[model samples]
Target chain A: MPKSINPAIRDFLDGRIWLRLHTPFTIEDINQQIEAGHIEIIQGIESKLVFMNRKSYTCNRCENTDQSKFTIFNCAKCEASCAYCRNCIKMGRVASCTELIVWKGEQPIYPTSHTLAWEGTLTPRQQQASDDLTRSQEINRSHLIYAVCGSGKTEILFPPIFHLLKQGKRVCIAAPRVDVILELEPRLRVAFPQTEIESLYGGAKPTMKASQLVLATTHQLYRFQHAFDAIFVDEADAFPYKADETLQKAVRKAVKPTKPIHFVTATPSDKLLVEAKSTGGISIINRRYHGHDLPTPAYISLWKYEHHIQKGRLPKKLTDWTNERIKKSEPFLIFFHHIGFMEKAEPLFQLIHPGIHSVHAAHPDRKTYVQALRDKAIPGLLTTTILERGITIQNVQVAVIGAEQRIFDKAALIQIGGRVGRSSAFPTGDFTLFHNGITYAMDEAKSEILKLNKGGGTNPDELPFM
Target chain B: MNCLLCEQPKQSSPSWQSLIAIEKSTLICEDCSNQFKRVDIIEVGDNIDSITSIFTYNEAMRNYLHQYKFLQDIALAGVFSNELKQALSKKKAIIVPIPMHPTKKIERTFAQVDELLKAADVSFEDLLIKTNQEVMGEKTREERLSMSRLFQIKPQVEIESTTYILVDDIYTTGTTMQHAALTLKEAGAKTVHAVTLIRAASEQ
Candidate 1:
């Protein structure tokens, strides 16, 4: 057999991500592609819960193998006991016999002509971090960007990204939260208008074009293998990413073995910081791109806030706090620990203004509601920790209703406080914690903000609008 | 022999009306009808005229339909069809089984919703066709709404003054049913109601 250069086969198989064989094509065509070395069979994982009789089945997609968790049924079609993994059944039902297919051919050779389109100048901190990142990218060495909140972390990413894209290498910016990816999508599109860029989350329509740049949630990385020349993980220490081992494995699997992976976040875990520092110099920037101090939360005692919500009334202090913002036509996010209490308090808060709405993890209008807040279409939103991070609203004041709840840990409180004063228009705003009593977590969050403010290394005396 | 699904002994016979409709051999004798949980609480909305489900889609129903639809077990459809048939005692309306897109039809040998209607001997016209082959089973409620352009009316359906009961296998979020109802009403349906074998719990 002779090797052939087939462009159609190359286009079909060259995507860095996994492509299931769902296209309208014949088996003979697939065989031809396979013979031409453009496609190969990738075996699915075997059952991790095989019994002694080898009659057990498990799902390899979500790594679910629990006997009780397995959805067992006797299939009359296959005439055998068939089991499906219900955990990831939404993607598609994966049975014991399901075959996972992947492309195994030469990838596309992109031209080194991609240009950065952003005209804004970077801050000194951003420039230094960008240079450090470029050096790391040059050697394909792992790096981290330990920048404070509102420290122009995304801008710091631009120069290094432009260099990598110009060199004709595929790169992905993966975040743990969907909101982060949503926020980055438009910014990245504007920054690299000429290059093909695809954004992949759970419901995002997968793009047909082979993108040189990709913005995706970490969960979407499971479908990729040796895809990116370099991968940047935003919100490196956020939940579901920090707790789930599979997500960490997914990021590792997404990038080629020889490629560099970088972490960028304001609240880096000690372990992450230590790891980054061990490998050469870790680029840490403590100052916001705007020369302003981090917002230190003001602790307010709203004794029995939950109790007041239960009585179908908002605490006078909380109500007054909300009314002030509403009267001034200011947009804000009031964080709650529980959805039930947040919903119960929503109508009472709505009494101040009908536009006030609440959202939780399962709210169907979460995206719309958040967008409205950004567009300032709504007065304010009652929310849970889902909006604690990756949400940027100009001049928005942050308030946590139940600051004493165990759910509002040190990291969560900081992230929620970080939501305030993020935009260039509003470099300083109030971050208030309304609680019956201040917990250690709240204290620690305040301390962390103050520490970052002191160590920001900027001319603190030159801070504006203080 | 015990019931194939519950494996419980023949506890109670099915109602006489349902018994007369099906052969004795196919009778799920473990009081399956006793297990027929009805969600009579109907919420009326703009696009969705009304929703009526015969069986409260519980755990067993999920497993049963999972096998019937995904596993392609032809036998389970008969069980569901029989269970739903005797209980469908409502206004006489033309049945319309939610359709699979042409691409999906080519992928799967048989249509899950169509097979149930066929097994039940229900008179249904293929008046609607799914335009997008995208699966809604795994999508979030927001995704389902955004992707609500999943269906289109078949060009040939002369729907001037006909009643339609949109037939589907399961009703969870009611997104698909609402889309179908909206499409039917837009095509000049006088009345559009939805019927599903089981009603899954509203996660909300």
Candidate 2:
């Protein structure tokens, strides 16, 4: 018969069993056990309890063990090797087991549930895209997933990404805007519940360890050097990224040599498309996911907001449209070509309807104001083209002031229209271009949308829209 | 080190290593060195202040500047700062480098002179602020001269009879330094002397 164990030893063993066997443990239980002296406290260590199996007794270095004669040895070379009973030598470098070692204290761990599962069926176009991404991944070739506005491009990426993660391959999705990264983070986290997903942008919490998947803005790509196995450049032609060669260099530098880079955009630049075609790996999804055609833009003449402001009045058509939206409690965005004009028009519209909110790049609380717009807490938002892409607000009407301005290029106008009619709940909305005269870019943008709407097979002149 | 421009052997005078390379083929020999007195002019008005530079604007200097301005090479700024300190050793005046437009600085992620001055351990003050001017490359010498009038001292910053040493990377026609000095004088500065990395040789 085994000798009766001491009461202190029994309590210590019980405490160890309680900690190791049970997870999501309560602090009250821990405090009770600590007060009973069943736990040994180690100060200055991170407040965590470490449990070791007490039945194990083996020499740490040479893996020799004697279960009946257990002892902790103080050897000088113990720093390099944990010296324990002779049996531990056979176990090889195993440390001696202690019972109920409690850390000082710990931050509360909240259990998070990941339940992001695909609920929607893939449309025919999305199915085709899914097929293409699989083929592209198998062949190790670059593929362009060109989907129109409101076409669940992010959702389609989930299937391929899930496949890659299962195979233990790393994936990165890079965009030019912080807003896009913010929008994609929660969606990605839900889709890959067990996989570690890192969202890297300015102001995001740094991941404690390297992750299998990452969502980062293009600027953040500068820090990575040939790290990712697959790279997806979203909004490939967006400002500062497209205009600056150094950012492009950074992207190229970050991507591994063997990995292929996928470009996703509603409107591809002529150069990018030409390169994609020449490279022989291109896939385009012309139709939106909503099953409705993309909106064809039309121009209305309204030259310079400055002239209207100086006259101590808002433009007649714009004011009438804005007042109707305000009366109906519908949220809307009025985009101006220039910041100066946007600033001038914002106050005039607010005076006409005091409930309306306006925001621009210079606003200190731009993020908060934009969130308010998204939540429909405000009726209207007056803005610059900074809100053109990477932001989604439900049931908002969009109008571009001074659409004929040189700054309002084809791609920009299309992206501004994309801001409207994004959600299935509010699938259709007005997208008007207020201009003194329709410019070539305006005509080009309208035609491009029409072409994309009609199955996208017209030999349209290649313009640098994206 | 050799003179980067003329390929002549550069000898450091007893004072500082940087002064010998400021201008092309223009070195104050040991005998003529006594004639060089530390000028305490607070404001650069009508008279031209003779300046000394440490290095010529050679390929290495251009590469260094390219890294400093475009690549955000913070480490290279340390070299620049040490060179500036050696060149302006005698001057007890506060060092003031030209200010960059806030917008440009934001885009570039750093101010060129701020990095240099911080690395060099010299006291810097915003004595002169840059104003809206045409692109430096697009403007002619006359245009640049007219445009230089825009650099002015802020009203709150009172430079009361204090000497200032103007620091800059390259001194081409001396238009920028001249305007800066004039503005400093207008703000009640006692004297202003210029020091740059390079000064183009005067045609004989």
TM-score to native of every candidate shown: 0.69, 0.55
Determine the iRMS, in angstroms, of model 1: 6.6
* Most accurate candidate by TM-score: 1
TM-score of chain B of 1: 0.81
Among these predictions, the greatest lDDT belongs to 1
Error of 1 at B37 (Å): 9.8
Model 2 DockQ vs. reference:
0.01
DockQ of 1: 0.05
| Interface RMSD (Å), every candidate | 6.6, 25.0
Tens-place lDDT per residue, model 2, B22-56, is: 53233223322232223222223353355555565
Q: For model 1, how does the per-residue alpha-carbon lDDT over A118-227 read when each residue is reduced to its tens digit?
A: 98999887898899999998887889887878777898899999998888888999999888998899998898889889898988876666788989998888767778
Candidate 1 residue-wise lDDT, B1-204, digit = tens: 445454445555467755786443453554564555667556575587787777777766766777666655544566755655654545688888889887666444467888787777676789898888677677887888887466888876688677788888888888888888888888888898887877787686
* Cand. 1 TM to true fold: 0.69
Q: Write the per-residue lDDT of candidate 2 for residues A1-466, one digit (tens) a residue.
A: 1222223333222211122212234555554546665444431101122366344443322223334333333222223212233221111122333222332222112123224376677888787787788678778788887778788888778777777766767788999888788888888777777777888776565454437678988766654555666888888888767875545765775677778888888878878887777766667777778877777776777766568776668978888888888787778888877766676677788887775666766477789988887787778888887888888888888888888888788889888888878888888888989888889999988988887877764222342233
